[model samples]
Target: MSKRILILTTIISLVFGLAFSGIIFAADDSYWQDHKEVLDELQSDGKPPTVIPVELIPQEDEATTALRERLNEIIDEYAPRIIEMSDWLYHNPESGYYEYNSSKMLGGELEKQGFEVTYGVEGLDEGYNSVIEERFDAAGLPTAVIAKYKGKTEHPVICFVFEADALRAPTREKGAFHGCQHNMQGPTAVGAAVSFAKLLEEKNIPGSVWAVLTPAEEIPPPDKSAMAKAGVFDGVDIAFFSHGFGPTSKRNEAGLGNCCYLIDAALYDFHGKTAHGSRAWKGADSLDAARLFLTAIDMLREHSEPEFRMMSAITKTGNAPNVVDDYVQIDHWNRNTDPAGQAALQHKAEQIDQIARGVAMAAFNEVDIRHYAYYYNGIEYGWLNALMWEYVHEYGDPEAISEELGKPSGWAECGYPSVNFPGIHVKPAIAGTPEVAGHSDENADLTISEKGHRALVQTAKIEGAMALRLVLDPKLLATVKEEQARWQEYGLEKGLITEDMIRK
Candidate 1:
């Protein structure tokens, strides 16, 4: 009986040991899976974890704790005002760059906080770029504005971006309403900034903190490329940004880096002369070319990728429906997994133009194709996001975030920034805090729930961590790129690739 008991005990011990071993092994595998390509990053930095003084990492210190309390107090104090603003903004959902009132109110709040506010700054045309920067991305529109926080630290500068854009109806109305919850990003970020600024001033924290209020995120022609051309990132070592989402979504999701694809692109414009119906033969039939162009595009649409997307605007079809129409121009925008795929689809545009040319020739007219507003996607920075997301899980309300969507563990997809950036770590993010079936149609309270406040607290903590991470160890920047390279290698092993990547 004693021998039998020993045997059972030994078997139980073996089972327990195996499970423990598996847990430890799994952790290494997870870390290795992400940092494998960056074996160099690990190998090069032979510093032992114990010796590394990451203690100075800006976190929820007593100062932060005190600041948060004060900030919460202020939020409570200003809850009424925020409710008024949120309700008004909620009722009036402006699409993309038309957020005039939203922008104006935000600018006013910042100015009241002692920020030398500027309206319509960094805007491409009237797009808007409000800079509280001791420095701007540049002395121009379409730039990031960083508010400098005075501080003493080994770290120098860090940025917190406030995205003041939203998804809206095509109608150019102020009350279009916030569909994607981009309206939350600005206030959450600014709220954090206010706390950080107050903390810095009250406690004399040493380091530069910038509350960068950026605009024009969702416009059809995002102009990110144009903004890039404008050297928006010339001097910046790191870029940190975030958007809002509905609760129970993938909030702290990381791994795979974010993958996106472009599906198709084309450009077709036709020109012809007009004449009386009786004298039709005497005039060029612009209507005929337009009709042919539409038919060709429609035919090609049938063969498009199952999950593909396409959109184009008839910028100019004709001055009037009468007179047979003199000239017409249609702007084209297309997407695909990669430019090569986009190119293959765009080749079909040649077929379209060939048909248009033939029709124009027969009609004694002309054809011109001008392409504009082309786009490529983007990926989130790896180490940067990993740290931000991981830190959030560590500090944020466990009950606030959900685990349903996005990558549960691992990195974002290697390629596809356009789509990936928006969805990376998408699960835990809250659209408006409540687990409502539909999106928020919030009033003055703008659906600001307790969960919403929790989300804001988490966001503030994440931003603070990112800022501290960037400033404290500038090397973290390179670590981020290395993480991306690892993501790319994993994607290659899995036959993954990014589409429409505009080469720098």
Candidate 2:
């Protein structure tokens, strides 16, 4: 009987140990098992897929032919200036928020082209304007530029967003370069705006063109969504935007199928009385409280949602080894895809604070917690995506361009930019292979290559055509506006349109 009891106790202990060690066994019956042979045949052949160029001929109508001819002529006329702008931006890169020269330069060029200019329109801190006037002679806020060309009254407002921030990665001369291809943004947007403005003037097209130079898209202290809520896009009818994605040209057809994860970060500080290491029992140990707090957080992963992610770094942990640590600071962050998931993660974070407090109380210490950053995911517009694709095929030769650029495919794919507006994010190919993945020095260099220049010209043409098309067809604008209304209603239900996201 005793032996049987011992055996049961051992089994229970083993089970508990495995659970604590994050070892779990689950049954697997995947559908892939039965289709391995067929799936294997579809595996990669170590080469990019061939892209067949789909050159769409405009509809055989006088209006369509005229629009196409005008688009072509505008591209031919502005090609040199556009390429020069891109080259200049490539040589001179600037980081986010501090894009003073970039903004001034781009804004000056827009003003030269007869667009009404507005400068220094971005400030984010609470009471920043009021406080700065009292403390300092001037308010030093980040700079952004807005250029407008009013064609005719009562027409659709087509806005183009130009991001003028470079990446601060390791490769550049001073760890600040246009690695994210933001250098391409200015040329393409300016080219499109200039062409569209000319078309409207020459043909009396009834529409307005507004080109916006937003500061710090790469790392936004004030991101695009914040800019929108701050009235940057107040009277904008629709926005035209694009990004670089490798050497292939793609469009977000289904809008942002999967949006960027919402992230929030906070700092927690724990305080205790210091004492000698030998006489540690006489004083409270803040490090002890921090340890238990982090342990609880690690244990939380087992029960948290699958999409949740959390990480922490111990920035401060006392002064000397001989004395008991009195103060400790922890910086932690959490991320999730949706609002509910983000809320859940936030709750967990709060619970961690409580845990810290509880542990501190037991150790006769105290803790202070403060949250610093919270980034919400932007909303997507699907209806606008379809319209953008029409313009892409109308103006682009995906296959021929892909072959010449040595890209894998000419087909346009989808993407999600964290901005709350109805705009199409197109990725036109630059020259050469993607040496580095995502945002790297290699990608930055490609932005200045000859192929990159061609990409700038083509993208401008595509955007120019799209902007013109929207003005010509008011029905499309009405449909998009309807879709946007429905989306806003849905977003309200999902907690996307919170009080903080709206302007007073």
Candidate 3:
């Protein structure tokens, strides 16, 4: 074995041996005990078995290996701060487009780490600005935070995207809650970015690190998509995102493919003249139009492809039963797996718009439809996915480790940016954690638990290692860029992306 591989083996053996003996960092003892086969396999080969095809994996040189070690050390050094930040976000939850304090806290931490922090995106289109003003009573996205740390060179800029918005909790006493565990994302990305930045400064590496804190993930009008359109991701070469703990205890895998469905969202407003309850026939009822619109949309389900989905919510209705309703507003979301299904999604959206209009006309109400958001499905890289999977298996909770490799699952955030550049979302399993569904108080509580702390550190280590590899290996970076370009072409050919999505 080479010296680097030998060193890696020794280190793995030492860490596992300590855990086995009930010495240090033994949060999941039963898991370590059950995974002795994995340890034996690593000890015999000095390298972890390939999760992806061996050819697709990048080989690390001595220099790159050393830099990776330093990166992990930096992440370790910042683990306390990382956990603290996550906990703070958990306690102080804020909803989308209103995460002012969350932004300040996360951005403040980055600023303390010597990053140049900027708040909010400039030059957003009038429509987006109007939405912001109408929704949150803010002029622009006041909570959007962008922090940059440039090294000796600007090429190969690495970006980290973070979400800090909490889900609205109408039932609970708190108006907003970190049920989705977005509280973990900002700290995780910040931890990784700050560590990578430190490595670049110390090693005098030529690159740039950007940590973009986007708000309103759980709500409509996806912030990353808006940010992408506003040129926030213009110069970013590659990006990385991290989320809360996984739902499975088995090893999670990553591969080439899209992660989520494409979502097209719109708001429909039905307007009519109000009339007294005793003489309701004297005026048209907007509520009737809204109900008809919803029923018509439901009728489309049978005609839609099995993968297509629609969700609608009535945000406004009649104020009193005694008076005819003058106005009704419905927010609708249409979704489908993309590239192959983009046309179907577009058709369905148009049909839904037509249904709204038809329903309004039948009810003698005027309907206004506003297209608010479109979340495209983004691409993933097998090489990066494999790299992150390897780190996840290495440092992740053994109980959560799955022996099976995952298929290509595309990223959801910054789908537009994913087409423009290469990116991956790192989702390492929290150690000794049980299966927990997202957008729950249980998941949010786990963000501050022992498993959550361990996962935070592991995620940062994985992200820093991946970023270091990209920084140290120019050939790998080039290969990634080429792969992205090919995927972009495939997207255009497959009707997954339009010519307009291609950045100049």
Specify the highest-TM-score model's number.
3
Candidate 2 lDDT, tens digit per residue, 1-504? 124323433443333223322332121111122333443353234111121112221233579558857877987798898888877877888777677788888888899999999985555444433333332232333467889998865346778887888887675557687778888888788888878888888887677889988766665233454455557776666787766546555543221123345666666788998999999988888888788778888888887877888888898887788899899888777776554453465676687677777877877788877664455544454444444555555555555233232211101111112333456565554435445766777787776777777778878877776666656654444434433333334444455444344333
lDDT of candidate 3 over 290-372, digit per residue (tens): 88988898899999888988999998887799999999999899988644676687889999999998999999999988888
lDDT of 2: 0.61
Alpha-carbon RMSD to native, per candidate? 12.7, 16.2, 11.4
Stretches of candidate 1 off by over 4 Å are 1-88, 114-157, 165-175, 197-207, 212-218, 249-269, 302-307, 310-315, 319-322, 331-364, 403-434, 437-446, 484-504
> RMSD of model 2, in Å?
16.2
**lDDT for 160 (candidate 1):** 50
lDDT of 3: 0.75
Q: What's model 3's TM-score?
A: 0.82
TM-score of each: 0.65, 0.70, 0.82
TM-score result, candidate 1: 0.65
Q: Total clashing residue pairs per candidate?
A: 55, 3, 11
- lDDT at 361 for candidate 3? 95
Instruction: State the local distance difference test value for candidate 1.
Output: 0.47
lDDT of 1 by residue, 1-504 (tens): 124323433443333223321211221222323334444343332321111112222244474456546545555554444444544555565555556666776666666776555443343322212221111232243233434443454123344555555565545553455665666666665655565556556655554445555555554343344344444333333444555545443432233322344433344567788877666677777767766666666776887765445556676665654467667666555555443354454555555557667767766779875443344323433345445555667655565555443432222122333222221232234434554433335421333555554555556656655554443333343334334444443333333334334223
